[model samples]
Each structure stands twice: as C-alpha cells, then as structure tokens.
Target: MNKRIQILSFLFLGLSQIVFSQIKEEKLILDKKREPEVKKIEKKKTSVETIKNYPPEEKSANPVTYDITNVPAVSDFKTSTIQGQDISPNFNTDYQNNYVRFGMGNFGKILGDAHISTVLESKMEVGADVHYLSTTGLKKEYDWNSNQSNATIGAFLNNYGEKGKLNLEANYGLQDYNYYGIYALQPTSDTDLKQKTNRFTINGNYDFYSNEILNDVRLQTSFLSDHFSANENQGAITVNLSKHRLFAGNDFKMNTDLGVKLETLKTDFALLNQNKSSFFNAALLPEISFYKGESYLKIGANINFLNSRNESLILPQDKKSEIIWSPNVEVLFAPQDEFRFYAGVDGGLKLNSYAELLTENPFLVSDIELRPTNTKYHLYIGLKGDIDENLKYDFSAGYSKINDMQFFQANSIFDDVYTLNRSAYNFANTYSTIYDNGNLSEVKGSLQFFPLQNLDLSAELLFQKYQLDNLDEVFNKPLLQATLGAKYSMLNEKLNFGFKGIFVSDRTTNSFEISPNNISVPTAYVSTENRNKKVGGYADLNLSAEYKINKNFSIFALGNNLLNVNYQTFNGYKVIGAQITGGVKISF
Candidate 1:
C-alpha cells in the first residue's frame, strides 16, 4: 500500500508540473551574473536625442550601475504555494511589440525609425531595427545622410539532456555614412565621401546549469564579419570555455576562462597594392571570489599570447610571437545596503579591432593603422549608494598607464606643403587614427534624484588629465564634461517631458586646414597663425515631450541643440544647432 501511494504521488506531481508550465511561463534569467532588479523611475544614463547615430549625436558610454548581483541561487524552497503577481503590473501596461516613429526638421531632414519584435511559442525572440535619416547642410547645402537596418534572432534551446542548455543568437546589419567637409573648407559642390558597412555576427553559448549550488560551466563561441564599401574587410572568430565553482558556503567561488581569438584584416586602398594582416591570440583568466556579510573580494590574473604573421612593425625578437601578462584585484565593503565602497586594479590588452573603430567614428581614412592598446596598469576607486531611498549616486576616480592609445585627429588636407601641425590628408574629408602612449587620470560621477512626486532628475560629470610620452596634448579629449537632466510627468501620468543640457570644456588638438596656406587669428592672449585645432567650449540643450494617447499609442516631439549654439566637436566637424522633430509611435 505504501509503495502504491508513493507512485501515485510522483505521477500526480509530474503531471501538475507540465500543466502549470504549459498554461503560461516566463522564466526570468539572471545567469548573466546580474540580478533581475525591478524598480520604478529608473535612471536615464543618456539622453534619447543621442540615439540617432549621426554626426550630432553623443558618443559617451553610459555609467555602470554598480549593483552587485553575482550570487549563488537561493536554495530555500517555500512550502506554502503562492503564485506570482497575476495580470502583470500596471506600469508595464505601456509596453508594445512594434514601434514606429517619424519626424522632420530643419536642414531638409526627414527621419523614420521602426522596430518590430516578437516572441515565438518556442521561446525565441526575433527583432528588426530599421531607420532612415537624411540631412542637407543648412549652412553650405552639402548633404550628409545615413541609413541603418539591422535584424536579430535569438533563442534558448532546451529539451537536450543534462549536458547543458544552448543559447544562440544571429545578427545582420547594414549602415551608411557620409563625410561632409569642415566648416573651414566647405566643398564648392556636394562631394562623394561616403562609406557603407555590412556586418554579420553569430554567437552561441551552452551553459551547464542545475538546481544545486555546485560548480557552473559554459562554452561560448562567436564569429563576426565586417565588409566596408571602400574594400576594407575584417573577419574574426572567438571561442571560450569558462567554469565557476562554489568553494565554500555560498560566499566563495573560483572561476576560470580560456579563450582563443583569431582575426584577419584586408585593406585594398590601391588596386595594385593590397595589405592583409592576420593575428592569432590565446587568453587565460583565472579568478577567486569571496563574498560575505558587508565585504566582497576578488583576485585574478590574465595571461595572453599574440602570434602575428607577416607583420613588419614588430621588433625582430617579437616578430613571430608576443606574450602579455596582467594582474587583477578588486575589493568591496558594504556596511549596509544603502552604502558601499569599492576599488579595483586591473590591466589588459585592448585589441583595436577594425569593426570597433568603424562604429566609434565612421569618417576614418581608408588606409588605417591597427595597433592594439596595451593597458599596463589601471587603478580605480569608487563609492556608490542610495540616499534617503530617493537619490542614488556613484563617484569614481581612476588612473591608467597605457600604450598605443588611439586618437582621432584632423588629417592633413594639403599635399604641396607638409608640416607636423598640418599636412595634406591622404584621403579627403576624413579623420586619421593616431597612436600614442600616455597616462590618463580621470574622475567621473553620476547621480539620480527624485525630489518630488512625478518629478525625476539626474546629472553626470567627467574630468580628465592626460600626460603623453611624445605629444603635448591628447587630441580631441576634453578636460571637463557635464550633463544636467530633468524629467516630469503630468496629467495623471499621461504626459511626460524631459530636458537635458550638456557642457564641454575647451579642448586643444593638433591638425587642421587654414583658409589659405597660412593665416592668423588674433586672440586675447596672443596671435596664432592658425586656429585649425583650437576649439572652444559649447553648451547644448535638448527637450522632449511625449503624450500617451492610449496604452499602445503615443505622440512625441524632440528639439536638439535648442540653444542654437554652433560648436565643433572635432577639428572641423561643427554640430548643427536648433533642430526639431515630431512623430507618433504605435505599438502592437
């Protein structure tokens, strides 16, 4: 009788599990070493106006959240059954599947953005992002345009026996960029300085997971292909196998990762002369982590070897192979949930991949140099926490000694006369990537505050100092940068408005063209023969408003550089002033 009862219970429970999951299941995945944090009034690290991916857009990266979520899975299983919150939450009602937007503004600009995303029955996500934007110069009538279309498909494959669950992703993208000349040298007619890029990427991971607090292992592989219109192409592939094992009580863990990276770059600037480079890399990372009440510590080391074939730039001894080693250490002290202190020391080699540079600034010269930046040492410290449950802040300072730091500077535009300060650009209307060894000291801070009901505010600031080995100044780097932002909701949360103001301190750079061979600009302090690299500070203000007509529809308008201040971020790339756009968004 006892055996029969046990068998019955097992059968009943198994059937119940299948029925409940088939009804509706949404598994929140946190295995990315991050927590699934839910909150209202989340911080906006960057202005939406910066998402256009155009010349006038901002390029700064968003601040880190500093929320430590790497922890072992909870083991306690509650006996009393309580279902999750049903019907979703009220705040999530505004979500949608498809989004469409259209806008027009000065400079003969007409822009449209559309996104279509859907989830399949097999737990696969398929999405496409398409946008079109064209702008004619308001000052010189030169036209600068861009078009971006990308598609992504991702899925998690289960049903395979215990070896692991497979996660896969595939992506394809096409983008176009144009180079309009400097304000100092406007083209008599529209020029044909443009580049088109096509990209394809595939990534996969097989994670070994179970309910126990034991060791975890995963295998990851990825491939990338980039083809440019100017006959430049790059192909890269990477594979990594990583493992994380719990050492003791949920508080200590050991981790290790081993990876292989391969890359090839081909450049055909001249039909008769083609340059090709291939690199092979092997990397190993091992770390130990300790986490307990109010304290967390981590120690790690990175070892790498790079094998370059047919490379003439390397020294004779290092021509065939190069080895690099770096140490990593991090510590955190959190006496309470609202306050924490953290510091870290690390270093590594940053592979200057072709694809990464193309995206950072597309107006690059055709014949570019590829030099990986070797970060010899990096030290950072920070304090982050919440204040009164309404304001959160982070402050960090870092210093780094680097080799082969790449800087974008104005290319010489004249061939007849050559000087270190200015020379003829090998390619027209494009910037050149210059490498220099340097030491950088930087301090950055961010804050988010909710001062009153329905009102939110945030601010960020960055300060930097550069000491170069050969150069007097670091090109295109500002000493200080800051942003102030505010957002408010009204009409019972039906209408939302946001405003952001940005400031960039004066920066000194080298390389620029003179109106003629040589010219002079008189300044308060002195008279210089040229002002090509002398750029002044500027302020930018932007405003945006959105009116939600219904749950799935909304109307929005945005004004960028509302102050109408014309400023040059690069030596000759002057940003537009006072542009407005409006569009309606619909979700399905």
Candidate 2:
C-alpha cells in the first residue's frame, strides 16, 4: 500500500508542472497579439497630447467668500504751469527744369541756349535742347573776318522700369568757320576761305538692372560732312556682360565687353582721285576682379581684330588685317578713408577718325589719312585723399610707350619764296598729320579748398614730356598746363561771382615747303631749314557775375580774355581778344 501511495504523488507533481507551463505559454501569446494596439496608443500619445477631462462637478465641504467696500483717496500734488514753444512753417522749394539764356557782346557775338525736360504721364522722361552761338567778325583792321557760328539741336527720351532702363537720343549740328588766318598772309575769296560742317547723330542704350550677364547695350551711328566734299560715317555697337561668382574661397567678378565699329571717310583729292578710306574693328575685352573691403585687383586683356584700307599724303595706300592684344591690370588699396593708393597698367588701340581730326584742327587738308594709335603699355601710380574736411588733393605720375602717334605740320606751297607774298597760296594754310613712335612721361596734381559753404576754390596742374623716335618735336602739344578757379555766392545766394584762369606753356612746330611744279601732290612738301619754330603761349582769364532779380529771372555779365593778350594757338591763328557780354536768364 505504501508503494502505491508514492507513485500517485509523483504523478500528481508531474501533472501540476505541465499545467503551469501551459498557463505561462497562453499568457505570452495573448500579450503578443495585443502588442500592435499598445504600440499604436503610445505613438498617438507621443505625436499629440490629449488634455484630461475635468473631474465631474462635485460639492465641496467648505466654501470661502469675501466682502466688497468703497474707499476715498486724497490728492496732495499741485498743478504746474506749462510753457509753449514757437514753431515755424516748412516751405517747399520749387525746382526748375527748363531754362533759356540769351547774350550779346562785342565782336558781334550772339549766344542762345534753351532746354526743356519733363516727365510724360509720370512714366517717361523726354527732353530737348537747342543751342546757337555766333560771332560776326573781328576788327576790320585785322585784315580778315574771323566769323564763326555754331548751332545744335538734340532730343532725348528715357524710359525706366522695374526690370531695365532705355535711352534714345538724336542730335543735329551745324558749324561755320572762316579761315581768317589764311587771309592774314594772302588774299582769298570769302567762299574759298570758309568751311561749313554738318553733323547728325543717333544713339540708343539699354541697361538691364538685374540680369546676371547682360548689363548694358549701346548702338550709335553718326554722319559728318564738310563743305569741301569731305565726309565721314561711323557706326558702332557695344555690349557689356558681367557675372559674380565664388571661387577658390573668394568672391570674384568676371566682366566681358564686346564691341564692333565701322568707319568710312571720303575726300576728293586730285592725286589720290577721291580718296576713300574704310576701317573696321572688333574687340573682345575680358576681365576678372577680386574686391575686399575698399581694395581691389583687376586683371584682363583686350583682344582686337583690325582691318583697314588706309591712305595718306605721307603713307602709301595699304591694306592691313591683324590681331592685337593689350594688357589691362590695376590694383587699389584704401588702407584708410583719408589716404588711398592705386596703380595700373593699361593699353589699347585707338581709332583716329576723320571727325576727331577735324574737331581738333579745322584747317586740316582734305588728303589726310586715318590710322589707329597703338599704346603698347601705360604704367601709372597715383595718390588721392582728403587732407581735411574742407580740402582735398590728388597727385599722379605716368609713363607710356606709344606707336603711330599723330602730329600736325603746316603746309607751304613754294620753296624759293622766303617771303610768303609772292606765292599763290602764300602760306598753304592747311595742316596734315604725321605719325611716329614715341615715349611719354606725365605728372599731374590737383587741389580743392572749400573755405566757405557758398564759396569754392580749385586748382590743377599738368606736366608732360615726350621723346619721339623720328620727329624733332611733338608739334602743338603743350608741355605744361594749369587752371585755377574761384566761385562765391553772397546775399542769400542771390548774387554769384566766378573767376577762371587757364595757362598753357609754349609749344614747337615744323614748317614745310612744297615744290611748285608738283602742287597737286600732297607728299611733295619738305621741311624748312629751320625745322622747329617756337610758338608763344598765352594766359586766358574770365570773370562772370549774376544777380537774381527773382526766382525765375536773373541778370548776368561775362568778361572773357580780361588780360587782352592776343595769343596765337596755331602757327598763324590768333584767338579773339578781350570781350564782355551782359544777358538775362529765364528759368521755369
């Protein structure tokens, strides 16, 4: 019986162990099935919190209450008196955009100028200008009529928008000049000695405000003609592109300029048989600049393609097509606001157009040639700074090597006629260009002093030295030049006075004599025994005063050549003497 009881106990213990194991497995399975729902609740809690609902209304065992009562307050401060201050009314000043001035003086002088500009529909700016100046003639005893007249009319339209700006302009000009200097040496008909020039121009420009590459574009065309059957026509187009980029751990600006120009000149010459010259040039300019707080460095080059059919009195007719390159580099450092330093080396090809030549010296011969000036290199260093709040100064020095520099030489018809009276032309009153390779050095300085709020004084000086490869002198080029000016206003700015003085140093020129037999050939002239001639320089002083009668009217007086020095600028040309003029100005 004991053995039977032991077996039964073992069986009972084994069965209990199996039952507990099954119960534990069932609990684990249930938890696993609910895991995803629990995780979802936890995720919702983390993503968005839910406020608990307030506990259901319940009666409180104890409650509290407070009583309200009114109380009076007393004031112990006294009121103080306030003082009033006087205020002045503000007035707006009306500005003038249109003005007309007319003046007359001795030597039968007449001057008239008019300008008007206004906004159209508050969107576009339109303006027009007209100017006329004339001088009847100099003293009759001077033996020649130095009459000159100039007139010009121009109109411009400007349109500005959020994206860009556009500008268009057209101009017409007329000029009449008398070759009075020629008459001083010989007698000639008024018709033969007079020159008239007509000029017309059209220009268009557009600027893109926010474009990354295309910044500005311009197109220009002009036509110029003279009474002697000399004509020049020019057309040009230019485009400027720039981009700002970051590279090599620094900010840099890349700029590119593309330009194309075409020019033609036609002049009738017996020897050359209606000489026609044409020039075509295209240029590519690229540069990179690095800028840092008031300092910068720029490195670039100008690449040019030049083609020309050129002929001149001295140079035989030749056709040329070539490519040229020039350096463009600059550095600037502004260590301080009051002091700055800069240095640069630059060069380029310059067009010597017929219009430019005629503007410089109106007595040029019809057989003149055209060429581009080659400036191989020009190195310069400069210093500019404000000495003080009221005074400023600048100084600079430069050196350059140039090729094909032009100079003017006077023409003579007869070699044997020591005295000009015997020859038909007496002194061929015409000039022609001569070119040479040369080196030039220059120094310049300027100063400005503002001693008073309404008064200004300024002065400038320049000095130059040239060494030519083949020419004896740099004809008609002044070695030294200076200018001084003073301006003052008083009596509530109603009265204004100004003074200006200009001084130029002496220059050197060459005289040439032609073989009478080959009068038609322009290249037949030879230098005189005295190759170099000295030309005396002169000083010109001018004074002006104006008294404003009211806001829209004013009376003014001008005095020119106050020293009355009869100075000759060219070989035979004498500038006008002293003169005075008084006029009234109207503003609206």
Candidate 3:
C-alpha cells in the first residue's frame, strides 16, 4: 500500500506541472489576440438620376415707370461742397526733446579642437565677449549701452625628448571697443566717442628632471602689449619659476614658486591720461606626510606675499601691499577597500591696504588723501568619505572675520554757507572721501553626495554679520542654496541626456543714523526693518548624439532648453529661451 501511494504522488506532481505550463501558454496567446491591428479597406458606390423635358421656353415683355425731373443732379452738389474753403496757413514751432535710455549687451563663444599627428598638433578656436552693458528700466528715465568684441588666433610647436620635454606657443589677439553717449541734460548734444585696443602674447616653457636630489623644475615667461586706437601704448612682462621635490625623504617634500609681473595702463582720455601699474606675488609651500598601514596624516603650509603700485599723470596713484599665510592638516583612515574617511582643517590671515584719493577743491587732487587698511582671518574644516561602489559623500564648514573694512563716503554742499572755507567764485560741487575701520564675520557649510553612479546632489548654507561705527545698528543674515543633477546614457552609450536644477534663499538689511552724536543714543538709532523673500525653479532637458555615417563624415545634433520655459534667475534678467542647432563634421 505504501509503494502504490508513492507512485500516485509522483504521477500527480508531473501532471500538475504540465497543466500549469499549458495554461500560461494559452494566456499568452489570448493576450496577443487582444492587441490592435492595422488593415486596409475599400468602398464602392452607385447613383442614378433622371431628367424629363416638356417643351421650349418663351420670353416675357417688360414694364416701365417714369420720374425724370425731380432727381438731384451730381454736378450741382460737387460745386457747392468746394465753394467755401480756406486751405492756407504758415506756422513754425521749435521744441527740445530729451530721452533716457538703458540697454543690455551679450556675447558668447563656440570653440573646437582637433588633433592631427604624432609629431604635430593644432587647435582652432573662436570667442566673442561684450565689454559693458547698462540697463535704465530700473531708473525709468536714463538708459545706457556699450559693447566690444575680441578675436584670437593661436598656434604651438611641441618637441619630445628622452627624459624631458619642451613646448613653445604663440598667440595673437585683437580687441575692438567703442564708447559713445550723452552724460546729462544740455541745450545741444555732445558725443563722447572713442575706440581702442590691440594685443600680442608669447609664451615658452621648459621642464627638466633628474634622478638626483632635485626631482623636477619648470621655467616660464610671457610678454604682452596694448596698442590703442588713439595712439596710446602699454606693455607688460611676467616671469615665473617653479621647483618640485627639492628634498627627497620618506615624510617631507617642498615645493616653491616666485613670480613677478609688471603692467602699464595708459589712456588718452584728456589728450594725455597715462598710468603705469606693477604687481608682484610670491609663495612658498611645503608638505609633510606620515604613512603607517591604512592610516595616514599630512600637513602643509603656504606663505604668500604680494605688492602692487600704480603711477599716473592725471590721477592720484599709490602703492599697496598684502600678506597671507595658511596652514592645513589632513588625516585619512581606511580599514577596507571600499570605505575611507578623511578630515582636514585650514586657517589663514590676510592683510591689505588701498590708497584713497580725496580732494578739498572741486577738481584739484593729485596725491593720496586717505589710506585705508584691512585685515581678515578665516578657518575651514571638512570631512569626506566614500562608500560601496557608487556612493560618495563630502561635508565642509568654514568661518571668517574681517576687520578695518574701508569704503568711500559721498558729501555734497549746495552753497558756501555750509563750507568751513570757501571762495565766492568757486563752483558748487560734491566731495567724496573714503573711511575705514569696520568689522564683518561669516560662516558657511556645505554637503555633497552621490547616491548613484549618474546622479549628483549638493547643499550649502551661509551666514554673515557686519558692524560699523557710522551705522545706527549692526547687520546680520543667512543664505541657503541647493543643486541636484543627473545624467543617463542611451542608444548603446552614444547618446547622453541630462537634467539639472538649482535653488537659493537669502535675507538682507540696511540701517541709517539720524544724528551725528549717535554713539549709544537709542533715540537716534534704528534696527533692521528690511525683509525680502523669493522663490524660483527651473528644469532643462538636453540630448546630444554623435553618429558616424562613414569613415570620413559624421553628424551631430544638440537641442537645449527643450521645453522653452521663460524664467528669470535674477531680479531684472531673464533666462535664455529654447534653441536647437545641428551641424555636420568632416575630416580629411
């Protein structure tokens, strides 16, 4: 009885499996039948009409009516209408018309490069840029617009060596600019129009390496010139030297660079307006590293110094100096092949000076009247780590403080009664002067993460605080921003599509003092009263593909802003609309 039962169980299991397979096949067939189909149809029609004629038609006679004498004549009415007309007047009127204008200008560049051979390489590039732009829609009355263009031609020659290499490059550039406009209201219009600029640049680089104490060294220099349209000329020269791995050791390395650049700017604004400026910057960097198993630590420091001077014939110019020093330390911990953690901190201090040209008389100022200085200090710390095969994360935070900030203050006197010392024949004009000694503080933080291989996301936040002696109250605010983007590959990885988005939020405040003796005077002081709020969002879809039609010919198409969403990213500026462009490329 047991054997018989086992046999029956096996038989039943086999039959059930066969039945399930057959049912699935039948369902699939039914699904295929339910799908729609396309077919052709033909139609035929037939019609019949019958007409019967009785006899030939005959024509009938006409009836007449008469009223000849009472109708008005057209000739009499034409003479009556033109009988009393006075069509002569001699008059003239003259009036002055004025207009305020505002406008915007834009320029862009599309560049391409191709490699030719092993011994020789060449690149072709084109670029256009606008110089100046003004918009008068904000003021509602005055408008201004300006623009300029530039073109570049470049070529290079490279040589390969056994242990080192050499490269020589030369570039020629041309700039064309024009300025023409009216300043203010006048009986007759006068034009302030001029055009200028030409430039030439050359560069050379040499790299040398050896298996000795010195690892590698590079030297470079360049020269530039500006030839203006009104016969104004200026020139500049720059020299740079860099050395790597001056000392070879298991834990320490040194890299240093010293550079000096000089520039001269001359202008013929008033038959002779020439100025020469010079700039010098130098830095020294050293890095030390210690490695043990999967844990490592590195420390680095950078010492920088800069100096600038300007000499002018018609304007007051002065010399300025700055110094900055930064030191950083980083540590990395890696226990596995796929996971790692790293953190670092960098801090620095900066000090700089600027010369303010002030005048007691309306138009007679030649020397530096006020010298304002500033000092700043900043600290930054961050941590970054990677996980799995496709996930990565980074976080950073920073803090900064600035002291002795400087700015120009404007004051106007309408008459001699308010002036301490005044001449009756002196014209009434505004006087402006610069003041220093303010304080500011800032804090910022950001985080970036990649959840997948094709997606990127980031968020940032910032806070700022400002204080000044002349203001009624201090200012403080916070700002937040975020961005997300993704890319996908299709059609055998030959075509790529992407999308991106950004968002930002911020707040600001301003304060004014009502009295000059407002030191700690609560009645004359005001608190923050300004509040601003805004929200904006935009989305873009892009598709790009490269199709190889043949060995020597190819085609490509790029469609940007596919949905044509008209939006504004700024207060007064609007985003560019949708555009579609395509081109074919040929190689020989």
Most accurate candidate by lDDT: 2
**What lDDT, from 0 to 1, does candidate 2 have?**
0.63
Clashing pairs in 3: 101-143, 102-136, 102-143
Per-residue CA lDDT of candidate 1, range 232-302, in tens?
Answer: 45555555444444454544444444545555444434211123345566666666666675477888877
Reference-based TM-score, model 1? 0.71
By lDDT rank, best first, the candidates go 2, 1, 3
Per-residue lDDT over 538-576 for candidate 2, one digit per residue giving the tens place of the 0 to 100 score? 677666677778988977777776666667767766766
TM-score for all models, in order of appearance:
0.71, 0.76, 0.46
- Which structure is stronger by TM-score: 2 or 3? 2
Q: In model 3, where do residues sit more than 4 Å from their true spots?
A: 1-117, 120-152, 157-160, 165-168, 171-276, 293-300, 311-315, 320-377, 402-485, 498-545, 548-552, 560-575
Off-target runs (Cα >4 Å) in candidate 2 are 1-95, 188-191, 245-274, 312-317, 414-427, 512-529
- TM-score, candidate number 3: 0.46
Candidate 3 on 454-486: residue-level lDDT in tens?
223444445555566665433222344444443
Which regions in candidate 1 have their CA more than 4 angstroms from the true location? 1-93, 139-169, 183-187, 205-245, 250-275, 309-318, 417-428, 452-454, 512-532
> If both were scored by lDDT, which would come out higher, candidate 1 or candidate 2?
2
For candidate 1, list the clashing residue pairs, or say none.
Answer: 412-423, 412-424, 412-425, 413-425, 414-424
